[model samples]
Target: MLLNQVPVFIFLIILSICEAKQLLDEEFGTDDVTSGLCDDFFHGTPWPLPHDSKGRGLARLCQNQIEDGKEGRIVFATMFSTTERIPVYTANTVVLHRDGKEHPRPGSKYWYRVSLALCSSDDHTFDPIESMIGHAEKHEMEQCRKFQAVTEDYTHNGLNLDRGHLSPNSINEQDLEKQLGTFTLTNAAPQFADFNREVWRVYECVAQHTILDYVPGEKVYIITGTHGVALDVNNNPWWMNGDDTDMDKNPVKIPGVYWKAFCYPGNKTHSAWGYAIVQKNENVYRKPDYNEYITLKEFNTRGIITAPFGPSCMDASFGVFSKVFENWDEYIDTKCPSYTKKKREEL
Candidate 1:
């Protein structure tokens, strides 16, 4: 009986090892088999390649919902010094809060960018992910090719708007690939220099620190995006100079407001918190007002932007843990008073 049981135990061990290898392959795209596994794992089928109508390979998250009326097609970025390959993981690994899209009318391209990754406290050094920018470049090149427009035409040159990152690099510092993934132009929107450098910049730092402090060593998802119309220095809506016929002449849409929301999936106490800042993309130089901080629900309700998580994620009570830090003002005052003080001094 003992001899018979030994064979069964050995078989079980072998099976476990095989499964472990398969999982690793699926996660890393080690080989063709792993590539197929990733496709099946994400799409649950192998019929259609993950390319969009433009023949660009969409990211796994974007591919999963191509049929769901998402606007812009997906484009995967290659690692800077490594071979070209798409990343694969379970949905819980990185949540694509919104898919990229090209909005109709005004011909203004509105790139919807937001995603989240779970962080491990073991490593905290934030490294730049150059691939994120590569993917964005690839996507922009595809768009340029479609219109027979030179790559320079797609640049926001002479527009006085800076290429702002919707999903900032600081949040995913733990993972090199994901950090690089944030560099893509697909994740960027045109932003006013003053707003981007002053107001939004400070909020980003506060949000990141809040996450690291509150959910230390836990799984946290950060979702961020931009919306609304861009304004000129005179507080007037800005549009491309030419008629809206060709992609070359089209102006990159500038968001009137930028928002960020973060969630701690591991937290049973509260779900998520979010805030929005309104910057008309003008020439004004001032720090963002911390008084603008609002609950995730209010931000969405007022802005008409969809919540990163479904509506259920919003806690109306504005509970203690809802905003990560108990007092937004206090946190800004204590943690980094310099951000606020410097703004006042400039004024």
Candidate 2:
């Protein structure tokens, strides 16, 4: 019996060593391992379900009526149909705010964009429904008319910015209904054509590909929005195109920067690996790179995200996959040559 017990002890010791090594790997740098996990950030708070004054949680193309003090509110749009009835797309909607005609600032905790999910499995294939596109346009027109009647604000047309969809159509390519839902003007915001088509487009593709490759079967939650005062080429805040007197005639506001955050919850090993990326909405073309990724702590510190992203659905350790790049040292050297040289000399 003692001899048999010795083998069990040996096995336990080996297992402990392996676990320790993995932890060390995460601590130092390991792209595949989960490095950060902050589960207590939410403090038992529940996810905010989308709703409006009328208690209508889900509306196709309607805008939520903002209360006098309330700057913004979220309203659900559509859900992705999955085989398991998992309801993978709750809180998958837009956050509307009131402010300017070219750029809008959502009040604290309000998303000036949309958040949603996409699920794909080996057996499932997503395809867009061409017919639904027309239907979606009709809904937008009707909703715009209703908005005009209630607020008398100008419609979302005749702007220099493109009607960029917060929840992009490409994300829901697997489901026709979800794809169509993205077309609603309510789900869009004014965006510079160059920024939208160039910088932002690349980032979106990288984000989508990262999830698909890392967690093939699980659902990925993507929260996207805009923030900050729009900037002119000279880096000054670009307010309404014309004087404030005519501002009421147009209410759309352009954004200075666009942001996206994503989380893959099924990776139990690295459940805290949430990430957020921000790109300037300008014409200067820069390809999406890993350096753009920042930790959730850094994101909050920079004032990019002010809301409490908690209750563990999004976790606390949200940020970039820090260990993915092999030349981090070299990259830093190039950016800060003096600093790198100083550190190396001291070492």
Candidate 3:
């Protein structure tokens, strides 16, 4: 019996290792995967954005849905760097709350999301929610590509233009559960990576730094898109009759400033679906004025633009914003990280 135990012990050890690795793949996000953590900024009350239990649960946070994305898309900042880790078995690690559940810690921001890892094997299409979001982008892009204006101008309308996601593929199921309001198509945007990577990336970074936290966790809602806005040829923020379509007519609150737009991401069905937020007060954009932060309740009355499209509309606030920070330079950074000859022409 003693002699036979060796093989059994060895097999058990290997199994343990395999299990741990599998969990890591589910919990940790890779550069290649969807990176769905903050892919969609949920609005309204907290609810579960459930999947078929295919993903490995990672982390979650409770955050505000208020946003200000008149000129740019919302922010999608990481709460904690990959180098950081929180202990779970012993005390809850760096983000343990007194209740022993993950939430409301001093420095920690709790967000609810079906945070799935970025493993190529993991597909959002496995569930209906994924399909819905996917359909919206695909269908919209199909229509967008055919539009004469889109074909003529790829930035606003072009055959090659695509929809860029603000919220990423997340691995944390708990976080998805808390979203409860952002699963609407209204909170999306059309972007080119050259633009998203350079200008949009920087603009969003500012919002994440100010409103979103990484360590413990910060719950922040975000949305992105390009619409017919009233702007000068310089891409400056402006109010226009053509830009003032439906949702842009009303004033949107970001931080302390009340701004409005004519056309943007979330102004369709709910006629107020799209919204975003950022840091820094500009003569063109807004500065944070909603005290230091905004909460879900405030977002409910002010931020959330419309109800979700499908029955699974509980956890969703993909258009929430606390501020609307916009710097064309940063916006360019997000869209055109490196200005190429083509990019120069687009501008």
lDDT per residue as tens, model 3, 1-347: 99899999999999998888676455443212233433353333212221211232222221223323112122222221111111000001011122233322121021211121211122222211121111113334433222111111222332122323334221121343222212211222233344444434444444433322221243223432222222335766432122434431221111112111111123234312222332222223222232333332233244323321221222223243322323434533443234343567798
TM-score winner between 1 and 2, please give it: 1
lDDT of 3: 0.28
lDDT of each model, Cα atoms only? 0.42, 0.43, 0.28
Off by over 4 Å in 1: 1-156, 233-236, 240-250, 265-280, 316-347
Q: Rank the candidates by TM-score, best first.
A: 1, 2, 3
Overlapping backbone residue pairs in candidate 3 total 96
- Which segments of model 2 are wrong by more than 4 Å? 1-160, 233-249, 267-270, 304-308, 311-347
Deviation from truth (RMSD, Å), model 1: 15.7
| Shift in Å, residue 220, candidate 2 | 2.2
Decreasing lDDT order of the candidates: 2, 1, 3
Model 3, 90: alpha-carbon shift in Å?
A: 35
lDDT for each residue of candidate 1 in 1-347, tens digit (9 for 90 to 100): 99989999999999998999776445433321323322321212221221111121223232111222333323222111011111211121232212222122221222322131101121211121111122123444443323111224335556556656665655555544444444444455556676776667778767666655555555544455544456666777654333355544544445566656544444567544434444444545665465666665565565333344444445433343445444766776665454447778799
Model 2, global lDDT: 0.43
